[model samples]
Target: MTVRSEPVLVWDGAIRLVHWLMVLLVPLLWWTAEEGHMDWHRRLGLAMFGLVLFRLLWGLFGSWTARFAPMVRRIGALPSHLARLRQRDSTPSFGHSPLAVLSVFALLLALATQVTTGLFSVDVDGLESGPLAIMVSFETGRQFAEVHEFNFNLLAVLILLHVAAIAIYRFVLRQKLVKPMVTGRRPRADFAGADLPDNRARPAAMIATAIFSLACVWALGNFG
Candidate 1:
């Protein structure tokens, strides 16, 4: 049973860092690509690459609230979740709600697609190209570039939906999703009967994930 009390931790710092950094990086990546700053674009792409990699690692090994298992149970429960949303009484999940889980997967898939395609993408003159562009034929690299651009559109749409969902949570549902994300805590009153998650991210997990992500990114850059 949930009790009203002071704010309690609901997110780990690394989880919050990955979320907000991606928020800032997505727009900057878009701008850099649009402005033809290929140098900075590649650098920023690597940074984004590292962040996404870290998150994937986090999903597998991080704190309880940041893991991937929660996305499974609630798939069939989505229509019910939406119905509750319409009634302004949507159930609050300790970590992610059903629809929020879907959004997370969609966004991550889109981003994964974006970064994967980008690694092999190539420009018209073969001048501005991904690190792995050299591994493929120019024609294939160009094709991947096209898919990369197309996937950006898909990613943009999902991002817009994410923002809209946040707005709904804040204004319509009267929930403070962003605050909990930033501060890593939520008012204990919000969860009526749910147990608090084991929100603390262990130092060992964080360090290992960071090192592994960097090594993976480094391997990709070097192997390409």
Candidate 2:
């Protein structure tokens, strides 16, 4: 847990893969929607739906650092976290710092909203519908579509803020946060005296997470 003189692993491999895959998927979803490719958009939306489920499941049963308990503790420590931030503390946290955890949670909430609403969305022409849209009345489905659009705007804004925060960390704080998320390691000095967590997801955890994620997506597609 204590910092090492060598680059220390922070994000697990599954976490990194999920993070980057969503990064790739988001823009493709946007492009598909903009080009009136409703079919592709729905397919990609389902893919993202699967990824989000995977992440939530992983947070529960994956790695020590990826659990909700630690994130909740970090959120509860906001006062100390803010004090350390004001002092320009460079001591790396177990995974994401408290402030970053807030943003992470915010982004997740926003993305979750987007996907949840999209599930019941219906187009004005009634020609396109979410996988679950048929389960709802036409008026209700249209309302969900409206919320889905609004949620996308919220998601876009959150994403901009996220990128800006990364820039601030890099230029203002002199911290290269993105690199570690990509490489899963941080330089020794960046985490000096810090108790860095380096838990990787076990084979059992990964298998369970993947199977459960797929099952949830399948149930929604078939039943709803």
Candidate 3:
């Protein structure tokens, strides 16, 4: 007997919202920072910081696929995924694949490090300082500023890699990964197995995500 797979809502509403919002905010933050728009940079940074925190929390307590455990695949499984792609076979993944999972974790870690370091950084003219700059030593702040700048550059490279990976998955591997993210739907296949989402009613969950995200930004701007 042939086994059939059931569709499941792996990425819940909150997960999808955070995923796309960060996609929008990351470029905005990078551009503003690059242009030396410190004011806008600071504002966007706060928003990004809050997002990171919220994402971390959501990863811990959100829906099935949103949790790190399910998504965090072993590096050893990467070869199997690649092989499936090569053969044009359906790879059953309820969450991120091993390679993609590592990419997501690395990107988040890099961004978090950059933001926290930026909190203790200081500008060249001594006029603008990060929110926590006053708490750290002048030398320490200066070091963090340098590291922050370096890490931001690394983050840019990682973003490019991420885009390239998606392109490869879509065009080369013939997988519609982007469509699933944008439309909240994955293509069904005969061998897709048990990895499909069942609940597609994530619009309300997305709204809650937006509200919670805005609340975080407001609190950060007003208090932090």
Best-performing candidate as measured by TM-score: 1
| Per-candidate local distance difference test | 0.86, 0.84, 0.74
What TM-score would you give candidate 1 relative to the actual structure?
Answer: 0.93
Question: Per-residue lDDT tens digits of candidate 3, residues 1-224?
Answer: 97555434545666676788788988898788778898988887887887787777666656656667667645668898778777876454656788888998999899899888878888776777677788888888889889999998899899999999888877776666776676554545522444354444445554566578678767656655
Tens digits of per-residue lDDT for model 1, 29-126: 99999998888888788888999888887888888878887656767788988888888995678888888889998998898888989999999998
lDDT of 2 at 76: 80
> Which pairs of residues have clashing backbones in candidate 3?
5-193, 7-196, 7-197, 7-198, 8-196, 8-197, 8-198, 9-197, 9-198
Candidate 3 or 2, higher TM-score: 2
Stretches > 4 Å off in candidate 2: 1-4, 195-198, 222-224
Highest lDDT: which candidate? 1
Worst 10 residues of 2 by lDDT: 192-201
Q: Residue pairs in steric clash, candidate 2? A: none
On lDDT, the stronger of 1 and 3 is 1
The C-alpha TM-scores of every prediction are 0.93, 0.91, 0.82
- Ordered list by TM-score, greatest first: 1, 2, 3
